[model samples]
Target: MSTSLAWESNHGKDPDVLIIGAGISGICTAINLLRHTPIRNFLLLEKGSQIGGTWNDNQYPGCCCDVWSHLYSLSFEPNPSWSREYPGQEEIHAYLKRVCQKWGLYSFIQFNSVVEDARWDGETLKWCSKVRVTGGKSEEFAKEGYVIKSDYLVSAVGQLNMPYYPDIPGLGEFKGTVMHSARWDWSKRIEGLNVGIIGNGATAAQIVPEVAKTAKTLTVFQRTPNWLVPRDDKKISGMRQALYRYLPPIRRRYRASLMDFRESWYDAAVVEDSDLNNTMRDLCAELMTKQLVDKPELVAKLTPNYPPGCKRIIISDDYYPALNRQNVELNTGTIEKTTETGIVVEGKEIKLDVLILATGFKTVQFMYPIKIYGENGRSLEDIWPSGARAYLGITVESLPNFSMLYGPNTNLGHNSIILMIEAQSRYITEMISQVHHARSNGHTLSITPSNCTVETFNEEIQERLQKSTFASDNCNSWYKNEDGVITNNWCGNVIEYQNRVSAINWKEYEITGSCAETLLKKDKSRLGRVVEESNSALIPIAGVVSMAALGVAAYLVRYGPRRIR
Candidate 1:
C-alpha cells in the first residue's frame, strides 16, 4: 500500500484504494483486494452505520431476496445455515456481517461516511475524494467534510440504495403516516389501519400479502401489472444443510445448477414473446386463476396487458391469494390528488390511515448527488446528460483508474446480481494490480477507455435492447430510461457477462507514462513477464480462466466424464 500523499487537504489516511459505498459490491471488492491482489491499504466508506447495502437498508415487512439463497450469496463464501430457500432481509444482513467478521473486514470500513465529491489529479495521478464524515466527534470536520487521497477509486455504491418518491400532487399535505418501502418505518403501527400501497412492483407484491393480514382495509394502486411466478419457497431441511456443511462440493454443485437454470431464463427476459416467456405467462395465469377463482373482476384488473418479459417478473405464492381477501381491493385508476387524509383516484376518494410507497429507487441516475470529475475537470453528470454509460459497465472513457461495480448495463433480470458483482470485482482487482505494479517501478500509470469503445459498446447494446421485451410499447418498466433506452439492464445472460468482464483488453484503453529503466533495474527480478503481460491484451487471463474452470467443474459434478469402453 502506498502511503505517499502528493497533495494535502485534510490530514487523513492516504490509501492505495478508496472505495465508495460499503454494500455488496464494496465488500466483495474489498475482499478480493485484501485476499487476491497485492493492495493492502484500502478504505470502505459507507453512508449507513453498517455494511450490507440493499440487504441492510431495506427492512420492510416480507422483504427478502427474490433469488434463491444458494446462488445469491458470494461465490467465495458459502453459507450452509440458510433457514429458507429464499432468505429474508434480516437473514441476509446477518450473513453479510458474518462474512465481514470471517474476513476481518471491519477495520477497513468507516460507517456513517458518505462520499461528497471525487476529482482526478493529472499531476499526482491520484484521486482526491471529499467525504462527508458523519458520526464523528468534530463538528467542524463533519460540516466541512474530510479528504482522502488514493491511487484508485472503486464505486461499489449500487443502483437501488437511494429511494425514489413519485411526483404526486399534495403528497406532503397528507396528515397520515407516509413512507417508501425502501425506507420502511418498523415503529409505525399498521394493525387494523386502512393502509394504501402505491405501486405493483416486487416490493408491493411482497408487502400486499404481508400487510393485508392485519390491515383493516388494504388498497393497492396499480399503474402496471407484473408477470408473477410462484416463489415456492420452503425451508432447507436439516439433513440438506448437514450435507452442505460437510460436503462442500455438493453445495457447490447445487449452486452451479441454480446458476445454469437462471442463465437459461435470459432468452425469456430479452427475446420478446419467446417460448420460455409464454410458458412463464401460462404458469402465472394458472396460479392467478387458481388463487382468484370466483372474482373475475379482480382477475381482469390484475392481468397484465403487455408481454411477460416487458417488466420484471414478480415471484410470490401469497401475493395473489392475498388479493382475494374480503378486506383487500386492487385499484387500477390514475391517482388524481392526495387530500389531508387520503388519495383521490378517478374522482373516488379512498380514505386511508397510512400510505406506503412501494415505488423503487432512482436507478437511472447513477452516483447521484456525488460530484465526480474526470481528466480535464469534466463532470460525470455533464458527460451523461441523458443517461449513464460505461465500457463493460466497469470503466468510463475519461475516468482513469476509476472503476464501478454493478454500473450501467450490468444489472441482471434473470439471475443473481451477486454473480455479476463478483465478475466486476475481479476485473477491478486486476486493474488495481496493474496500478500497483507501475507505482512500484517508480512510474505513475493512468488508464481510461477510448471514446470509440464506449460509444460502440453502448450503441450495440442499445440496438439489441430495442428489440427486447424491455422496449415493449404496451408496458412501462423502470429498466428503460425516460428516453426509452434500456440503461438499467444487460442484454446478455450472467455467463455471457462473466465472459465479457473476465479480462480487460489493453488495446481498448489509452495508457500513459513510460516505464523507467533505473526503477526497473531495482525490481528486475520481479519484473519481466508479470509487468509486460499487465499491459497486453491477454493480461490477467488466468483469473478469468479460473472462474470459467469453476463453471466447468460444476458441470462435471453434475455429470462425470465417460470412460473408454
Candidate 2:
C-alpha cells in the first residue's frame, strides 16, 4: 500500500486511474473504484481547494438542492440526519466533506491542480495529462506544470462548474459590486441596499426571497419566466431523525419512496402534451396562483408561455410570495443596456447598489477549455464539431480507456442525477476491471467503443430527444447547445438508463492487446477445479449444475427486482 500523493516518487509508476474534479460525480467514481475494483492506485485532481465541486463553488444565500435531501445523496452512503426535506448548500457541502473524510479520500486528492490538457498516447497505451499547480496550498509542488500518466482517464469535471455571464452591452462597466450567483461573495453586505439581480432561473428563484427580506429594494430582471413548482419544504422533526438513524430499513424505504415518486414524473418531462405533463403544469399554475393571489398584475408577468418542462422547472415555495413583497419588484422589460450606476430597462435607468448575475452555468460545454486529444492526435473539439455525445454518456468512439461521468445527454429533468452518476461509475469500473484482468495476465488492454456503436446510440438518443419537451420548438434552454442540439439531458428515465448500462456488451467495444489465451486458460482452470471436486459418476451433472446456479445468481444480482439501493 503506497501513500496517495507519494505514488509518483515512491513507486515511480503511473496510477491505474486518474480522475478530474472532486465534485459529486468525481467523488462517487473514486469511491466506486475503491469499493468495487482491485484497482486502488488512483488519484483525483481538483482545480478548487476543496472536495465538493458545485457545492463548494456556489455558496450564495438560499442556495439549496431542489431535489429531496434523501434522494440527492449517494445510495450506498445515506445520511439520515437531514435537518430539512431539502438540504441547503452548507449542509450539502459539509456532507460531502464528511463523506470524503470517512472514505479517507483527502490524501488521494491534489487541490488547486488544474488539468490543462489530456492526450491519449497511442504508442504507450496510456493517457498523459498536463496539470498546472496553481498557487494555494497546492503550491507545495516544486514545479508549476507537470505531466502525469495513467492507464485510464476519467473526466468527472461536471457541467455546472463554469459560470456563464450573459453578453450584456455594459456588464463589465458596472461600477457597483457585480457577482455571479455561482461565485457569490459572502463578505459583501446586502442589508438595506438596493440590489438588482439579472436572470430568473432556478438560482434566481432561490436568491430572490432571501435578498428581498434584507435589501431595501430588490429589482429582478426576468428575460423569461420559469415554471415554479411548490417546494413544500419542511423541517425534519427530532423523532423522525431518530427513527431514520436508528431504523435503517425505514430510511431506506423512505428514500425508495422518494425515488419512485420522482421517477413517476418521467413522462411529464419527456412528453410535451402528456396527461402527466398537463397535470404537472396545472399543479405549478395552481401554486403560482395561490401564492400570488393578492398580486394579479405580477402573476401575468411571472406566467410562462412555454411548456412546463421546456426549461428547467424551479422548485420554490417562497419565490412567488417574495415577488408580492413591497420591496421586491419583478421587471419584465427589455434591458437596453447597463451603465456604471445601474441598468437601463425599457430605455429607463433603474439605479442599483449591487448587481447580481444569477445567470446559470455553461451546461452544454461538457469539458471545455481542457484540450483532450484522442487517436492520431485528433482533438476532442475536432471530434465534437456540433456537440458532445458518448456511447452511453460514458465511453467515446476514439478515446480509448477514457470515460466520463455526467457527460452529454445524462442530465435528468425529474429525478436525481446521483443515480445516473452511480450507473456511469459502475460501468466505468467494469471497463477498468477488464483492463485490470488483462494486465494481471501480462498484457495491456485499450478499450474504446466502436464508431458505429457510438453513432447508433447518439442517433437513437437525439431521435428520442426530438419528441421530448426539452427540444420543444417554443422554448430554448441550457439543455440545448448553440446548434439547437439537446446535449445536456437524458431522453429516458433513471431506471431506463440504469438498465441500459447495467451490463457491458463487449461486442460494442473494440478491445486491443487483450490476453485471450491466458484468460481462456484461467476459465478452464476454474472449470477443472469444479469437476475434480465432484464424484466420478456425478462429475458431469455437478459441473453443469454449478455453472447453471452461478449464472442464475449473477443474473439475479444484476437484473432482479431488489431494494432501491
Whole-model lDDT per candidate: 0.80, 0.82
**Stretches of candidate 1 exceeding 4 Å from the true structure:** 1-12, 136-143, 516-565
114-176: candidate 2 lDDT, tens digit per residue: 888899999888898888878785566425567788889999998898999888899889889
Per-residue lDDT for 221-285 in model 1, tens only? 99988887767678999999999999998888788667655665666556787765665566567
- For lDDT, the strongest prediction is 2
Positional deviation of residue 309's Cα in model 2 after best superposition, in angstroms: 0.7
Report the poorest 10 consecutive residues by lDDT, candidate 2.
525-534
Q: Per model, how many backbone clashes are there?
A: 0, 0
- Name every residue pair that clashes in candidate 1: none
Tell me the alpha-carbon RMSD of every candidate: 8.1, 10.3
Model 2 pairs in collision: none
